[model samples]
Target: MTNTKTNYLFFTGKGGVGKTSLACATAVEMVDAGKVVLLVSTDPASNLKDVLESPVDENIKAIKGTNNLFAINIDPENSAEEYRNRVTQPLEGVASKGEIKKVREDLSGACTTEIASFDEFSRFVSGETEGTEFDVIVFDTAPTGHTLRLLELPAAWSSFTEENPEGASCLGPTSALKSGKERYHTVVNRLRDGSLTSFYIVARADKASLKEASRTSNELKELGMGNQQLYINGVFKAIDKQDSLANEIEAKGSEQLKSIPGNLNELPIRTFPLLPYNILGIDKLRSLFNPDLQKSISESTVAQTNTPHQELTGIEKLAEELCENQQHGLIMTMGKGGVGKTIAASAIAVLLAKKGHEVLLTTTDPAAHIQDFIQQLGELPATLQVERIDPKVETQRYTEKVLEHKGQGQSEEAKKLILEDLKSPCTEEVAVFHAFSKAISMAKRKFVIMDTAPTGHTLLLLDTAGSYHRDIMRNNMNAGRLRTPYMSLQDQELSKIILVSLPETTPMREAGSLQDDLKRAGIKPYAWLINQSLTLLSSITDPLLKSRASAEAEVINTIKTSYSEKTFGIPFIADTRLLPTLLGNKEKV
Candidate 1:
């Protein structure tokens, strides 16, 4: 039954939901069953190679052991380079060098990166894979927000091309779209055809993740990719009934499963149990396909557990430092999606607020659940307030502001074009960044804590900041105006970037990449936070839990040694129903 739907499988959801793992496991299973499989990862920050323990680069390569399995990682920058050449190669004879150079520069922006990546993946979706020989293609896509934008591109670009056939828009001349019309249309049709494609909305058994999954499911249905399934990953079920924390996590997972959204009830659902150790390498990944393999592995891992433990500094310690020093500045917690940045941010804000500091906590994350969690806490903190820099609201506000001021003397036709251009996704990034700048400006008065969007989008926002700094510097030729927002971020005394991540390889790898990106943008992170360290938990009898606890000792040690002065390890809590309690001293592990 699943074979017919195996031709094209798309695993998408919020970041850190184990989409890549599940996709790879499924592909490995198909390969073991003698079916040809091609696994393609379209995420710009892809960890496909790390997950597979093999090199999967821009060009497709065969898996080490599997004769019929192959994989590829689409490089967006390379794609943009190729895409630019395709658009400007023919103009060399007709246009001057400067003209060609300008065209290339225009194509080198974020918008072009997105379209180029889309163009590369569109070929596979359209069944235009010239060299690959495979029966099934599995796509491990980017995070939810980015994936939705990518999915919408075929129709969005198709409409723009149809309307402007010969006119130039964001991506250079409209003639560029002429050659790709049929291909884009084909990709659109193939995506909508239920028989040819299937999407599995992957999520965890938590309120925030489930809610995001439900929303994504509805949106996918709207896009006509209605043939869908749901996979609930990282479900924690207690092996020792007496273990209160494990039981609490188990009960919460069960409750969330029972309350599954009505819209998703009709779709088939699969649940994967949370493991004690990270699922890395071929043997561990293959264990996902065969449940019986888990127990033996768990037993072996638990038996090998022998690590010394020492007291680790946690968020409470950091809170003490902040309170003692009366720290007041911009506090930013950032990492890949689903890595518990929201929880970390909330904890910090709650701690500071309890210390009677005026803290304004906010987020720019699309899958934000801060308000929902705060509501669950029953009451608001007197010293703390929460707000979200909503992209849609900010974009609308920005558009109206522009129309009222810049569009004042324009003709109706000119005004209409301005409105249309404002609707582009690029405008939302700028608007959100504008809001971010405003938030940074508020740090002079009180503590400003910002929970940023996931890694990819956050990088884009920072890139916008970098570009804006260059533009303003070029125009003003003075550092006076730049001293406000631009210099504010670079000032360590005025701003602190807190990098958060799980102890697992993927999140840490991405966190390292995120740190590098921030450094490149001239923003240095003040600290590294290792969230949900099982090493901090009490002695565990359950084999799985014990094994997990043992594995975390090594990770925690690495963070402590490498970032001893600045690293903080936050233990995993059993219950998070009350934010205050969860982040309070009473619950300190």
Candidate 2:
């Protein structure tokens, strides 16, 4: 039987879920089927070139040995520039001289960057571009939250246009929406049509990623995006039955796997075995996508073993710790990219709220899915307030205020330069730090849970504290007037850091580094939460899983020893961690 499906696939989930690898594998599969395929990555950190083992850049490049396969990384900034020109070109003739300049400035905002990228994305989805002849088009997306926002932009932009029917042209709102109506409608229609698009929530076979996928799936469904398939990647199968460590790990993994949560179980679940080799190059990806090849590889390498170890029940330990002291402070979750920091943070927030603490859950992570996760909570108690910090908005407000203080007569070029400087990563850190300070202030009254950015970003944010301190000292009297009241608070008394990690080697190592970094900055963690360990609660049966579990035990011991007893572990949950209804049945302590 011939498969006649028009493949327009989007891979999204929590960060670090192997979306890029899966997208590459799927595209390679289509290419091997003698079909033309285009793999496009919309992620800022596009690893398509790394995965394909080719030097592909912003433009489309054909993969070697694959006649029908091509890949491209869509540069959002370049797309935004082109879009700005296109929008302004027609307005030049109709708009008055002064109006044209103003329109150009308005279009230069950060929103323009987002709109431009969405426009490029829409062209592919709507089949409006020259390369629309491909039999399949796969998008290797960023994390779930950003991708969803990008997908929903057409509707948002449409609403904005409708509200201000006059185009935001130099002509002072006199420009008609009719001018852009055709293009706008085309993009909106493409996004809404399920027949033309399908999404796969790619995830690791761990509690946090699985929970995030389930939550993201529900949010997308509510947003009218079609239900997504659940692609569970990195599943470890037993290769050696005699190895106790291996068996113990697999047994634990199996327990979690068998108990697939309610929200996730209904979706078509596809499993990919854990591979010894990194899925970076195209050949490896091609091999990974081949069913027969993968099956043979999995069978040959699978190990079964069990090991003895003391386990730490994460939630129980956490509950006990929290109950011992109902002190108000901040619990910040920090980690590397794609390591489930946001989900871990959200889980902490939910648990604290359930325990009757007035909690304000917030995140400074540039790519956070906190909102999506919280929406699944379904009517949280009045004491729980979940909010997201938009760095862009904060930066914009800061920029405008500074400009107002600088006052008029600045040349357009100078103004543009100033705005660009304000949009720099450094400025973003400052803006986020200002907000962080305010949130920390609120912890004096209630529990504040922060889902911090990735390690590098968090370091930059905390560095701002020192810089602000220096700036304040330099301008003593003036500093007092400019400084926010929140900046004066000490970190130790107001905040408690929580390092979150999985049982895997990479995550644990990263978490350790995060702790060291925070400690060096004089920020000691109150506790550490090791998330999604099968070995923590059950015996493993797969050799590889057992080894992994053993490794985790070592890490856990290290954490316990190093942190002096402020470490906890949250075991893998069988069911999806979506709605309260789904997660209501608490696991036995």
Compose the digit string of candidate 2's lDDT tens values, residues 27-144: 8877777898888887644557767888777777888867788888887657766766776678777889777655655554444555566667766776766743788888998666
**By TM-score, how accurate is candidate 2?**
0.59
Worst ten-residue run, lDDT, model 2? 169-178
lDDT of 1 by residue, 325-415 (tens): 6557888898888787888888888878878899999998888877876776666679998999998899889989988887898999988
Index of the highest-TM-score prediction = 1
Clashes of 1: 0
| lDDT to native, each model | 0.79, 0.66
Runs with alpha carbons beyond 4 Å of true place in candidate 2: 1-4, 80-110, 167-179, 242-245, 295-337, 340-437, 440-449, 453-589
Q: Judged by lDDT, which candidate is best?
A: 1
C-alpha TM-score for every candidate: 0.93, 0.59
| Model 1 segments more than 4 A misplaced | 81-109, 166-170, 174-179, 320-327, 479-481, 484-486, 563-565
